[model samples]
Target: MSTPDPGDIEPPRDPRAAFAELSKIMLGEQPLSATLERVAQLAKQTIPGAADVSVTLLQDGEVASAAFTGPLAAQLDRQYEAGFGPCMDAATSGTTITIDDTAHSRRYPDFARAAARKGVRHTMSIGLPVQRQTIGALNLYGTDDVPFDEATQELATAFASYAAVAVANAGVYASTATLAANLQRALESRAVIDQAKGILMARHPGMSADAAFDLLSKQSQLSNRKLRDIAAELVDEVQRGGQD
Candidate 1:
């Protein structure tokens, strides 16, 4: 379960550089998908024997492939459809799944055979956990028979952890943006509705606010339109009359 010292392995990219790159991506203004796509590409460069890479993301009870380095997208899609494979296990179980040699692997036999046919002999899936639940996985596929040693596993885990932070931050940003948009729309709708009510009251002297609102509601129901839409139309009509 131990690997040779890092000095002995000629990794594709320096682990430190990989982490620094991830940190930069996380801090950038890029969206969640862009960050994960960069992460998958960095993983392929950082892992010693990585031939392909893909990110598996789960949000709102649906699982999907977020990004990939190669034809691994098709491979991952097959696993999703079948509900099997190391990526699925990692994301659902929150545990890293490693297959050193697909030809001799008993776990995920079908996946192993399929991967082997695609020249992927070694594979690993590291869970990306957020808020106590695994939300995604960072998957690595290699065309070598060598097992991923402890150091490699550790590197992959680090990559996934950083990716998880990025995912969480992106989720928060998206939610905040959606909330702001909804609030702005609500405010705009309210302003128009109020304007419509004011016009109704002014046009019909002695009409109460409640009665004016009732008029708008009746018009909305009769026209099969939403109250807001009807309100907007009334406000537009008042503005047009003002110009005339």
Candidate 2:
């Protein structure tokens, strides 16, 4: 699900508690998706008049929904499909977008219309600073007019500031995981190829290690298969022959 279930969200006792919880989430070992979902849920609990919350992330020049709470994802989807909204403007321009009442909003007529249809009366979008630039936005939606006061907006901004660092760290962790997997695969391929080469050398009199490897490479090229695959097949065939 795009948005987190309300039952999963724990209400914080106060702003201090909310900040502490957010810090814990940042330092936790949970994956990026879980961390982002928790951040959105916390935003809903921490901000007054916030019926829903969503995080819009911009990665590789593409905008995507990272996490959300309540039915906010559906509302954000309408804004994205229409190609313009407060959330989009917030991320792109590195500025805050706020509307006290969707019915009276003229800056984003289409977005206002869609949010009004969705029973959203007030909204706030704050840009998230990532490193040296703004890379995302934290969005809050209210069902009543003027749901967020100035204090609420300031608190949301502080949360977004810390969230930016957490998001960037998650990206780095994901990349490291992928690199580690690839390296492990490469090591396995090398070990199998070496074993196949040793088998070839032992089976043929006067055959050098390099010649055996060349033979395996030629077979791989002629069969249009991976070198690792050809090496594995040779090793299996040798084992079967020995057994017989």
Candidate 3:
């Protein structure tokens, strides 16, 4: 019920500079593991009282991919395996959960034991969603016992929002790649059609390849056909004439 203290932490002095760094880090040219490592770096430098972070993606409350910041991540996997922790609660309940001190926290017994072993005394987690679909959670860990103050919580929330957008952008990048591939294939097919046209034109000295192709294209269009069909017809005609 108590709000976090915003005054405890300061927002980035230069939002543009922060974004510039994030943009470089978000570049998808590298492998997902490399990209995720950069994401963790951004989270570490931007968030206060956070020595490490972990990002876990979820689909229907099941973990799809999990990336850790460092040593903390390996330790936290135990909590996930225990099947009782803030991560699950945030994903299923669609709520932001914070723990002041896992040592004394009674909410998730298994989580506390694991946290104790890992030396993570505090945590703040925000659930990520898209149109009522709880996709995953952005979970942050700290050594502080009092948990995230207002400033820290806001920063975490912003990071989580960016994370959600980054995931969507990744999907967009994939779609763009697929479209590019299709475009290339269409171009290659067109190239083959042109070559077939040239072969047809060479057999008839008075006609040029371009003129022949134009004629074939016009015929195909008039007949409501594909250019490949016209090109195939010309190729078959040339082959039969060569035998004669």
- Report the number of backbone clashes for model 1: 0
Better of 2 and 3 by lDDT: 2
List the global CA lDDT of all models.
0.72, 0.71, 0.61
**Model 3, runs deviating above 4 Å:** 1-16, 19-31, 172-244
**Residue-wise lDDT of candidate 2 within 139-231, one digit each (tens)?**
988775455788878888888887777766665565656434433554566678789989889889899865676677667657767677889
Better of 1 and 3 by lDDT: 1
Q: How would you encode candidate 3's per-residue C-alpha lDDT over 6-65 as one tens digit per residue?
A: 344334344345456545544356544445456666676577776567765564345532
**What is the C-alpha local distance difference test score of candidate 1?**
0.72
TM values, all candidates: 0.64, 0.64, 0.58
Q: In candidate 2, residue 101 scores what lDDT? A: 82
Measured with C-alpha atoms, the lDDT of residue 186 in candidate 3 is: 41
Best-matching candidate per lDDT: 1
Worst 10 residues of 2 by lDDT: 1-10
